[model samples]
Target: MALLSHDAGGKPVRAASGANATLYCNESTAGLSMLHKELAQLDERVQRLIAAYRQARLERKRALQERDRLLALNAELKRRIEGVVERIRLLESDQAQ
Candidate 1:
């Protein structure tokens, strides 16, 4: 059993659930439509942001892989330099002898 009431314009408005509450046709309907539109726009914006975030994550992953590869190459180069220095020291010691 829904109760019916009238707005200020004397138009019979449907009342919401509860006692003595009248729904303003213009305000409620228009506001809801506007809110729905804004929500849809916000949803689309969120989807785009999510896609961008995923792309950034993929880029970050590739960058990390490249960094790891470079670090390994640096370590290998450092080891070779150390070996060359040891060989030079050994040769100089032999010459001194």
Candidate 2:
């Protein structure tokens, strides 16, 4: 007897060609059910990975904005310090005279 049967969809049909046809059908059904469960698990994992990628991209953008703000603040502080130094030098020269 043939150990396997084919359905119209080409998936293994749950039947045997001979006396043990019932047992074959049960086994085939169980296998297909397990395959469906595994596929569901894989799908959930893929969705979680996609969510994590989006979160990482958002964090990177925030970091870049913070870096730009700090750079602007540093430039402003440097300009103020240079102005103060020039004033101190002028004051010292006037007192010396």
Q: lDDT of each prediction vs. the true structure?
A: 0.82, 0.86
Question: In model 1, which regions exceed 4 Å deviation?
Answer: 1-26
Candidate 2 structure quality by residue, lDDT tens digits, 15-78: 5466578677778779878979999999999999999999999999999999999999999999
Q: In candidate 2, which residue pairs clash? A: none
Estimate candidate 1's alpha-carbon lDDT, on a 0 to 1 scale: 0.82
Give the TM-scores of the predictions, in the order they appear.
Answer: 0.67, 0.76
| TM-score, structure 1 vs. true | 0.67
| Clashes, model 1 | 0
